[model samples]
Target: MRRLKSVVTSAVLAFGALAATAGTPAQAATEVRYVALGDSYASGVGAGHYDSASGDCKRSQLGYPALWAGVHDEYQLTDVSCSGATMADVRANQLSALSTDTDAVTLTVGGNDAQFSSVVQACLTKDDAYCKTATDWMSYYATHQMADELAALYRDIKARAPHAEIAVLGYPQALSATGTCPVIDLGSAKRGYMNDFADALAEGTKAAADKESVTFIDVRDAFQGHGACGSDPWINNLSSGTEVFHPTLAGYIAGYYGELDGAWS
Candidate 1:
């Protein structure tokens, strides 16, 4: 009886040791919280109506950020992009939207700061050389100034979301080379200005990202043939006189997916 009891006790001890050895320490899951900040493009202004549950800021789930989040379910997203948002808006106005746990961020801004819409509007209304020259000068100043602002925004995001991966998106071309309308004409000079403006914004974004060691994804080349001029264009035109230029749903999807593939992959 004593021998049998000893054998059972030894077997139980060995089983407990085996169980302990097989057990492993639990690993912390990779937290991927996405915080989107910036202006109309980030807000998805031209995409469609906003979700009332999200906020009154007109943020859309169909926006690139949301689309990115949808595909990458691991991310917890906080999209605070609004139409007409300036650099100051991101620094000062978007604090409420930021969380302590953000792991990634993306933004689109500076066009409004350059008053790009106003430039397009002016181009549509005026034909004089003086107007064109004045607009060109303004575009130059705005481009440089916007670079500074973009740098500032990058700094702010770093400060707020230290662990987050940052991506500053560039604006896509708004008009076709052939022009959207005969009446609301966009000539070669104007087209050059717009494209140049986009290029400047892209450069500015890159400079800012480089300064902070942030990952800057350049979508300009990706969007080249897919602009308003393409047979299957991404940008939208004023169907009548009311809607001048914006992105179509397909355009937004392309932009969103491109960014996602670039960033997540």
Candidate 2:
């Protein structure tokens, strides 16, 4: 009777050990293959820290893509976003990262193609009159040319990452259309033009996204009070070369990624 009792106890213990070993977390998280693509905003140029190996691409670990990927272990990210990437540049340099297995993609572009940054630079280097001409041209380009350009790019991305859900993120409002702050105080005329430029760009990008059946995430409202002229600023100014008009770390975390989190399905 004693020997039998001992044998039963040992068997019970062994079974419990096995069950614990194979317990609750039955399997690891399903791996989601994610690819980050597009220009500086996607690359996190202004967010400060960078992956030096990315070279001029300046892929920031704090960028919206990295932030989103970091929160969920399921996501495996390949960030290929680069600074100064035009639509053509993306097709040439970045699209190769995409494949049928790519589950998620986020892109921010078209501002470079429209020469929006150059307009800002003009206001800083030259005068509001020069900026006004540039802004007018940029607005026209955004309305007339950018939509079709973006549509073509979207189609190309869809073709490459056939299974991936792509979201094209639009830029934030860089300055409030009203008031003056020494930080970025472009006169009200230039500020108004910049605001119009943002509006035109958003319309074009959104139209392209709708036409292509991808999602377009507008960041304007998300960054409403954080523009240069606002109480708090999320965008960097002539403070640096590459980071000009780019988002700060806080902006990417709470603004860009914040809006994206809600849209992510």
Give the number of the best model, judged by lDDT: 2
Minimum summed lDDT over a 10-residue window in model 2 is located at 18-27
Which residues of candidate 1, in runs, are more than 4 Å off?
A: 1-31, 53-56, 128-131, 179-183, 240-243
Computed on alpha carbons, the lDDT of every model, listed in order, comes to 0.65, 0.79
lDDT of 2 by residue, 114-169 (tens): 98767877776777778878888888888778999999999999999999989999
Clashing pairs in 1: 238-243
Query: RMSD to native for every prediction?
Result: 15.8, 13.1
The TM-score between candidate 1 and the true structure equals: 0.79
What global local distance difference test value does model 2 have? Answer: 0.79
> In candidate 1, what are the lDDT values of residues 1-265, reduced to their tens digit?
3533443343344334434543343224573778888776787666665667656466765667766655554666667887778777777788566655777888887777777777766666776464466466655765576666677777877787777777877776665566344455566776666666666667766776677777777766656665564465667665523324566555566655555565767
Q: Could you tell me the lDDT of residue 197 within candidate 1?
A: 60
Q: Report lDDT (Cα) of residue 235, candidate 1.
A: 72
